[model samples]
Target chain A: MEDQDYSPKSRRRFLRKFGSLGLGTLAVSTGLTESCTNPTKDLESGKKITLLNSKNELVEVDSAYISNLNKDLAPNHNSESRKGLPGKKFVLVVDLAKCKNARKCMDKCQAVHQLRPDQHHLNVLLMKDSEHTAPYYMPKHCQHCDNPPCVKVCPVDATFKRSDGIVLIDNERCIGCRFCIAACPYSARSFNWVEPKDAEKYKDVAYDIEKNVPQKKGTVTKCTFSADCLRDGKLPYCVSACPNGVYYFGNEYEDAVTNGTSGETVSLSELLAQNSAYRLMEDLGTAPSVYYLPPKDRTLIPEIEDTHS
Target chain B: MARLNTIVAILIFACSLGAFSQTTAWEVSADQATKKNPLEILPKNLALGRNIFKRTCVSCHGEKADGKGLIQSTNLIDEKFQKQTDGVVFYKIITGRDKMPPFGAMLKEDEIWSVINYLRVLVDPSAIPPPKNVKLELTTGEEIKSITAIVLSADSAKLPLNEVDVHFYVKREFGLMRIGEMSNYTGADGKVKVVFPEKIVGDSEGNVTLVVKIENNFLYNDIETTAVKKWGTPLLSHEDEFNRRALWGARDKSPVWLLLLANGIIAIVWAVIVYVIYNLFRIKKAGRIFIK
Candidate 1:
């Protein structure tokens, strides 16, 4: 039965049946409501409403079946966002070799989070390990550490690490204390300082813990690893926006990561082993979810002037 | 001071020149431009090339080959692009510039040539050939933890198909995890075997669904088959660790010692305050009695 359901033919049939059933219920409810509101109106008015049927054909249905759905029925994501997705441990692999400071990931991330110009949930830093080492562009996000120091230092339980290997901040509960920011070695967290960008626009918007939008004043905000997108089975904003294919994100439990640019999925263990991938500040024992492949054989050389301090 | 200013002006001009050069036409070496395309412009080859182009190139180069995809790229059917020798186009693809990623590592030499052939057909649709289909049959060998794929022509003759690239993958949450090597083409016998890697985690029941596919093949339409096998080790769930008392755990899951110590200290401080207030009340009552 499970196998049959997975078949394309059966799945399409199931969708057709389900779609009609939903339409029928909607029609009945709207028709009943109309009769209750005004009994004098003729039930057989013969009004027609255009609708795209399940078969992708334009068909006219009785107008009685249609009703305006004014209410936004999106489920409140606040409480559920705290709990992590089960049976999965998300990991991100940043190929430093491929990063050419495209800044597309940063732009998309900042736009979605509604951060100010100076604020950054994800930053591409120019780094030189030593005087002899070549400089490279490193896009750093919240490590979403398994042993997060920020979580430990948070005065309030506002900052937390979910079971799915994501570190999130609940601005609603935050006291505007910057202890987490100070504690974070990666400098991943940022304070709102003043009001967040476009505060008036998001005034009526309910705060989504996953997206961390409707950001409160003075509260700290950091990368949620695009938790909202992950819930919808989509790649993170940064992961999908990278044209350089620098990001490879997937569940560590599956031991696989799919490259954003090339759309190629490879074994996580083998990729790490072969590429000699290393975590940022591994000696700190942060146990970061983000791994980095060295900047060996870089695609584009960094300009000498851009490397100046 | 005058010399310093002159040097800085020269540096600024050099930087602007560097930036301007990037917008110019892509350069192709004379030797690279003269090289010949190895793949023939046959219908089968074009079909295979089209399949690959659709999978890899269509994202950056629009489905119509009009350079209007997710990202702006050179249109394959553009006159300037079409005029380029097949080798020049191949060289550009192999060694990408700017936004275009180098396909050298991802695609095999034959696959790259096939894509170039497909580009020609895009410029002239008359080159597209008739289609062919193939059937894939998968069998698992539990003892050796291996999977064998048999490819055959879809016609009644059931002739075995060879030189078809067979890709093996295990279904994952976000995407498919490729197994074995990238180059797993079938031999003349129309069979290819791949041994599953050791200690791959499956479901709690230790069952994994393996997919065998003849994908992006030039001669045949894409075909695939799947089978469930008890080849993987059972996944060890981390729910216990998540629920366990720790520093990083949720409020309710805080460490027992920390919870006890914090609540214990609060209780002690409050008890002491209450005792002192009670003693003060007693002293006031005694003073009233003496005054009376």
Candidate 2:
């Protein structure tokens, strides 16, 4: 091989042959093809495998490759993204009394998700409907409605309601139609009209709809209630990142919602009753998982300029 | 053909050289490159760095820092990455290139250095020394609102470790809720005293799981000790409030009027279906008699 003469044309031909036949044989002999086989068993044995990933690249025993193998490989929501934690019902309570339009929650959510400059998973809007009523900042995201209009209108089952009360969009199954975006009454969903600027960064990452990072173009992305962190017994980014203790997140089954700022775990029902918690557009009967308390006692008269509707 | 082979070899050599030179470009001044890390590289620093990494870089750098992150970028475990000077790595992190966002704006300098120290440990596990043989003892006095925690070497006669910062925490549902931190150096008697605030209370049982942690020590492995005591006001009021709340469309929340109307509608629809079936059978019998 050292003595052999080489030319550019001959090198190309050699590479072509080596890439197809030699690599293919390497893939087969190494049992890399087993990823498409008994993936769960292979995963348990800690066996390394090389297989074609969703991006059509040959990946080793890596997360990007594992994500593409099959959802059946793991029934857990951390990987499958659609399923919820068994026997768990998630709920959020935003105390309007605490919010001062600080927008720390929105900033943290954007930073974590690598959201587009215009698109925000958590939107903090200002409401002063009448002269009689005072203004308050309302942070809104996907309510994860039990009777979700978006889920009902979706032509494909791409957008689904998980058992834990999270509404997630499977970018792989979405056909770029904006039916779900239109169906939403709260304007929670945002569309990626063009390839996100950070798309190249996620080129090698396997998609986990629950985390909603490495956002794909032409697909709808919304707040996933930080399902990934919840799996690890951690609070969602927006909840923990808030400075004013505006957000409370917990499992309804546990009947407690820990405020991010104070680290105070309050009974979900008691908090709702004491604060008069109400959901957005309740008359529509969407039955949202997120509830909001009236912004009765003001923390600060929010600077009106900072408010985005 | 021979000339082409020579050219190919030259190209490979040149490409390698280019990659080598690029790493050198990241190097700071000689003094800065050799500068020691101001912050101690202990498990505490690593833990803080780990938290920051989870929030900031996990999406791109991955949980294991293998560069298999959801937003795939650099494989932190790459041998080339491990070989870079601490200063060089720190510079690269602060001033990111295309695809890699600049973290300098978001993270403080100390935090960036901490992350680099963490990356160092990841590259070489031996960088973090093994756990030292230190035993931690925590106890509460007659008053539940106060406690005494002590640290000593397990093998020796309880020699007090002075100037060690002991952290007090209340265990929350999701994670440890750090109520406050007190820097206490152990006294001559091998004891550091901590007072629990009246506010750091627990559940309805008047119980709080207090965690005392001594971290960032150069001499010892991080020690985390916990104690459950009857202290502080009851944080929780009612656990069974959810049993009958009119919320979240639970069965109890179903309106009586709506339930009655729905049941009535179902009865009417079923009754009409049964009548139609009865009429169809009689019509069939009448048709047979006429035919006969």
Candidate 3:
């Protein structure tokens, strides 16, 4: 016998509720404004954005279908969010005494930034002075200079200094002229020649400057200091990733620095004073936020012989 | 004289051909064929031989240890194939012909002897006694994590081991996973000491049980001993905020001197250019009147 109880009218009522619920989800996920009436209709007619599906295969989805969930798995920067967190002055100290070129910081920073293979947001350079002098490992990131030359040459004001001691790049606004790259004495900036694999994977997500993700082709990117992680009251990726007690990060206002490798908290001023910290290229008057303690009386011998550029 | 030399060469070539034709069948001399394996045909030797055979000879001779390998022309398990002496087998493996590749250059003589012992086991399991007397005892320092594993014989006398591959494994959900490997010959004391690092401590509580094992050894049984100890501090993964004060932070000054100097130079240059332009205009006007 044919079942007559499952009627079309009830099924239509269930679908109507289900459709509204889906619209509600879409509204919340996209952070869409209240004015976006008929969200589902707009999504149906929206432009398609290519992105990798759960299976890691490229698939075309509506631009509105893009969510932060996919983008937050790994992160990047765009052209907005130039404002710094109020009352925060970020500073980094590299204790050269502890670094053994484990390269954990480099690996972690690269992973979180989703940097291309050729690009390095943080570089660990092997340095040796003379044949008689001992060798040491020096890891360099964006100096985030107070009087950044990169900022001065940026014709469109795409790269700017923040109040919180961070030099950020608005990738979307960059014309890829590479003027800032030339101006930067520290060689801190990296110009994207092509769309990176990470950007291709999360193609649907709208780019965020703070996250420094969904990186665009023909744009510039540098070490963002993981500003989003900082906002979440967390250590920068490089700070936590180091196995050796190399990087020290804290707010200058707090006057305290925490060592990620040893999990030790110490007064910022005391440590810097005792170590005789100095900034790289100080004569240039870039006034860099990062300071370094000279590698002396090292815990272990520098075993790496060759210095890679 | 040339014809005489040619005749001599022809005679020599004929003699060589005759010698080869007369032999016909290749054979090992009775003295060489009767030689026995020098290595003891114990379970340990058999196991080592089996491991080597599985890695190197499994492709040619199938997993079943029979001649039914990928290119099977000979049956090793057959009574007729097994009838050959150990020396004969060893010679054939070293100097191969027809389809088989020569393994003399690839494997050591002792390894080949082990393979022969393994083959013997396949033919008769009961012939070789299992290694029951060899024992391994592992002891570790709770505070320092200095691990010492001693190998002993049946009479409780220490046995010197050479070139042994000892593996230390920690017990995980799915059997044992190897943590570290050490290759060292024991001195006259028969003890191997290793100091585990403070960072690789197993769990949060620092409660770790290590299973020390000797693998692919011929002298002793593949024995394992475990020792629980409080060794090292477990690595804690967390986020920490750090700060440093330098001359880099934003100051209220705004480089007033530099700004004033730059603007002052610009103002002077612009003033001169504007005055020059005005004079040039006036001259042009005067020139027009003069022409009229």
Best by DockQ: 1
Clashing pairs in 2: none
Sort candidate 2 into its docking category.
incorrect
TM-score of chain B of each: 0.78, 0.56, 0.44
Per-residue CA lDDT of candidate 2, range A5-60, in tens?
25543423333433454422232233334443333433444454566533356644
Which portions of model 3 show Cα errors greater than 4 Å?
A: A1-80, A304-309, B1-292
**Structural similarity to truth (TM-score) of each candidate:** 0.79, 0.46, 0.45
lDDT score at residue A260, model 2, on the 0-100 scale? 71
TM-score, predicted candidate 2 vs. hidden true structure: 0.46
Q: Given candidate 3, what's the lDDT at residue B288?
A: 100
Query: How do all the candidates rank in terms of DockQ, highest first?
Result: 1, 2, 3
Query: Candidate 1 lDDT, tens digit per residue, B134-213?
Result: 88888778788899998888989888878777889997766677898765878898899999988787877778889887
**What C-alpha lDDT values do all the predictions have?**
0.81, 0.71, 0.68
Rank by lDDT, descending?
A: 1, 2, 3
Better of 1 and 2 by lDDT: 1
lDDT tens readout by residue for model 3, A1-309: 123223643323323433343432332245333223333454454586664433344545455544564433323223224657655678899988667677778888778777866788899988877877888889999998877888777777777776677888877788899998998898988888987756657677656677567677888889988887777777888887775568888766545566664444455677799999999999998889898999876655566545654
Give per-residue CA lDDT, model 3, range B1-292, as digits (tens). Answer: 9999999999999999999876565477787678789999765566669767765676457777787553454677789768899888888887765445467876899889999888877878787555444567777765666787776664645455534446566543213434544254445566777776444434445566777887555455677788776663542322122121222222322355666777899999999999999999999999999999
Write candidate 2's Cα lDDT for B1-292 as tens digits: 9999999999999999988876664446677667666777787677667556655666557778888753356898789888878877777777665456456776899888888888887777776767676788987786446777788877867677664556667766665655454346567666777677655446666687888877645346678988888775665533243233333233443467767788899999999999999999999999999999
Point out the higher-scoring one by lDDT: 1 or 3.
Answer: 1
In model 3, the Cα lDDT at residue B146 comes to 75
